[model samples]
Target chain A: MYKLYEFFASGNCYKLRLLLTQLNIPFQRIEVNILKGESRTPEFLLKNPNGRTPVLEIETGKFLAESNAILFYLSEGTDFLPTDSFEKAQVLQWLFFEQYSHEPYIATSRFWITTGKAEENREALNQKRAGGVAALKVMEQHLTEHQFFVGDRYTIADIALFAYTHVADEGGFDLSKFPAIQAWIKRVQAQPKHISITQQV
Target chain B: MYKLYEFFASGNCYKLRLLLTQLNIPFQRIEVNILKGESRTPEFLLKNPNGRTPVLEIETGKFLAESNAILFYLSEGTDFLPTDSFEKAQVLQWLFFEQYSHEPYIATSRFWITTGKAEENREALNQKRAGGVAALKVMEQHLTEHQFFVGDRYTIADIALFAYTHVADEGGFDLSKFPAIQAWIKRVQAQPKHISITQQV
Candidate 1:
């Protein structure tokens, strides 16, 4: 059986859960409370040296960390991964962008504001927001013209970026500013088997 | 013609360039100096809104951002990307780890020391280094038994991690601390088309 160790409200964990639901995959949910430092415990750290959440443990006891990785794993051989070589690479490209560019700005800002740490570096937070909004605008522009991030259909790229971006407002980002992103979010939500983060299977 | 817009010292660009060399793919290199903020110009941003280094311009002038994406594009349909679904996901898994777990810590620490930004946040810098070192230890433990990152083969996973890690000392990381990684670096360098950042092709 596949078991997912995750923390609710974490964009990273949410990405994994969303993909599993979209694919109709079955897995047990193991909650790790970041607030209580459950992930940092000796047992959890043994499972993941980095002590981060959203680890997928296969039946063989092998575990996979990193949300995007889990998405790729669950989405493999499915429509979520493009067959064309270049398009497949494009999927990876956006996934990397989600981590390096978008997540750093959007996810961090969300973390600070959601956890009430935004006031300490409001100026820096705003600067990151400017950068994050710029990133969202870039996505908005591409998404406005294309149905998916890489090709004509939904891929793991969309899943990876969709995690934090859908809730970017919690980080004090004004999603209403980017009409294209708003529409793109709707398109993603409209997927036949889509699931929200708060859903229990 | 396929033209690669890149900075000399960027690991992301190096990953692409190294793959191009390995594949013997013909491409022209156009320098974008990150230090001079050339990537942030209107002309460059038109190619990639992220304004980051290593934009791969395909034959149709279509620009591709992110290094791993470029690697996957250039090495498409080749032996570089595994055919098995799980194996392919494993590659993505390592690549994702390179970004979230390894890159943020190792690459950022290296950049901090290389560009003399370490003084700006010495405490935070040390934290990143500590985290980066912790990550390297994971690699060390893994490398102690395996030659490549996953499945005993040289894949883009190695390329992504090798980019910043080979020059970790530039970021004030003492390579001598991790003998396994040091040996693994040599193993990668011994590849048929291995290229160094300082080497001019």
Candidate 2:
């Protein structure tokens, strides 16, 4: 069984949990309180030198870090991932977009605001709001034309982006203007075997 | 032939250039001067709504954005990408690390400094410097134990990371302390058909 070292509140960690449950893959979830610096311990560092959560122990001692990479790994040869080379790369395009362009602003802002660091990060939060809004506009533009992030089907790309985007309101983002994204959020929730971010499996 | 819309100075764009050259794949380079807001123009926005450079035109009318995604697409089925599931995911792990942990700080700092905006963005630059250093430390840790990023062979992961890391000095990041990364950079440069960032095809 796969052992997931994760912080329960992290959207990155939730990406894996959602995928694993939808895939029917039985995995053990070991909560790592990132707020408490549990991930920075020497033992956890051995599992992931980056000291980040959502480390998937594929087997004992063998691990994979990076939630999107873990999603790619588990979804390969499955319907959640596309078989066509171009489509596969398209999936990856959005996954990278989520990590690079989307998550840092949306997820980090949510982290700061929800974790009681909002007052301390006021200037940083203002900066993040611009980036976060820009990211949402990109998604809205893409979602306006397509039903899903890749190939008009729900894939890991959707899962990756949806993880934080659905909760962007908590980050002080005004999603009311992004009707396309709001509609897509409903569509993602309508997927088979879908689970909420905070749902325990 | 692939048409790469890129800014020559961007390490993100350079990743594709290096891989295309090394793979011996003939590609047309269409320089999009991002500094002049070319990427944000309506016409270019059709190519990539994200308004980012390093958008790969796989063919006419079909564009792939995100530098690492383009690298994955171009390198697929070639020796540059691994076929094994685990190894392939490991390659992606590093690619994500590059974009999320490495590029945002190192590459962006280089952009700010090299473009002469360092003075105006002094506070932001200071924050980016810390992030860039932390990212380098992570790379140094990994390179210390392995010759290559994944499966002990040069892959697109190296290409993705090398694009920024080799030019980190321009970002005001001192590489003197990261001996492992320095040695790995040399190894990456020594690869067959390797090209410098500024070398036009």
Candidate 3:
């Protein structure tokens, strides 16, 4: 069986779990408390030099890191990842956008705020607030015209973006302004195998 | 015919040009001077709402954005992209690494320094310096053991990384310590149809 080294609360980890559960693929979930520095331990480092959680251990020794990369790998040969060339690129476009543009601002703010670390770094939080809002604006604009992020289908791109976006309010981002995104969240949640962010494996 | 909306000096844009040249794929280059806010204009926003350059006009009225995503799209079915599932994910892992870990530090530093803006943000440069060093160290450690990033063969993973890495010195990063990366740079250049970063389409 595949093993997932993950922290339950992390959206990055959740993206993989959500996809696996949707596909009904079986995998073991090993909790790694990042807040406790468990991921930085030497043995974990041996598993992933990057020292990150949500690592997919293909077997005893083989492993894969990076949440989006894992999503791409697991979604292969499935309808989750679009096969059309332009659609594939667009899926990847959103994946990169999620990492570079969206997650950095939205997820970072959520981590800092929800963990009660927001008090110490008001300046940093303020800085991230604008960027997080900007990312949402981009999504809001796109979600308005299209139900999903790519190919008008429920795809990995939606899963990748949804991981952080649905819980964006936890990061202190108000979702009230984005009606399209609000509806998209419900649409995703209404899927046949939809799972909550807090759901355990 | 394909058209690339790009800024000549951007390493992100350079990655696509480099690959197209190596693949011998013909494309028209339409330079968008980002420094002048060209990318942010309404016209460009229609092409890519993200308002970033290196937008690939796959056909009239159809476009794709994000540099790494474009590379993946153009490289499909070519030897540049790995065919195996695990290997493709490995390539993506590195691509994500290049964007999140490597580019933000190394590429941003280069932009700030070379554009005569480094003086205003010495603290930011100093902040990036450590992260940039950390990224390079990771590359050095990996390259020391393996000849290429994902598999032994050259792939778009190398091209994505090479875009910024080859000119990391412009960012005030010292590559002298990374003997393995230095050697890999020479190896990439030694490949057939290799083009310089400044080479026009």
Q: Top model by lDDT, which number? A: 2
Arrange candidates by DockQ, highest first: which order?
Answer: 2, 3, 1
State how far residue A114 of model 3 sits from its true place (Å): 1.6
Expressed as tens digits, the lDDT of each residue in A45-125 for candidate 2 is: 999988898899998899999999999999999999999999999999999989988899999999999999999999988
Best by DockQ: 2
Better of 1 and 2 by DockQ: 2
Ranking by TM-score: 2, 3, 1
TM-score (chain B only), all candidates: 0.94, 0.98, 0.99
DockQ of 1: 0.71
TM-score of model number 1, chain B: 0.94
Least accurate 10 contiguous residues by lDDT in model 1 chain A: A58-67
Expressed as tens digits, the lDDT of each residue in B1-201 for candidate 2 is 899999999999999899988889899999999989999999999999889998998889999999998999999899999999999999999999888888889998999999999999998889888789989998999899999999889999999999999999999999999999999999999999999988878
Instruction: Tell me the spans in candidate 2 whose CA falls farther than 4 Å from its real position.
Output: none
For every prediction, compared with the true complex, DockQ reads 0.71, 0.91, 0.87
Candidate 1 CAPRI grade: medium
lDDT of 3 by residue, B1-201 (tens): 999999999999999999999999999999999999999999999999988888999889999999999999999899999999999999999999899889999999999988889989788788888888988987888899989998898999999999899999999988998999999999899989999998766
lDDT (C-alpha) at residue A71 in model 3: 97
Task: Estimate, for each residue in B1-201, the C-alpha lDDT of model 1 and write its tens digit.
Answer: 789999877787889888888888888999998888999999999898778889999966588888877876776577787867667667877787788778888787777778888899687677787778877887888888899887898888888889999988887788898898998899889988888987775
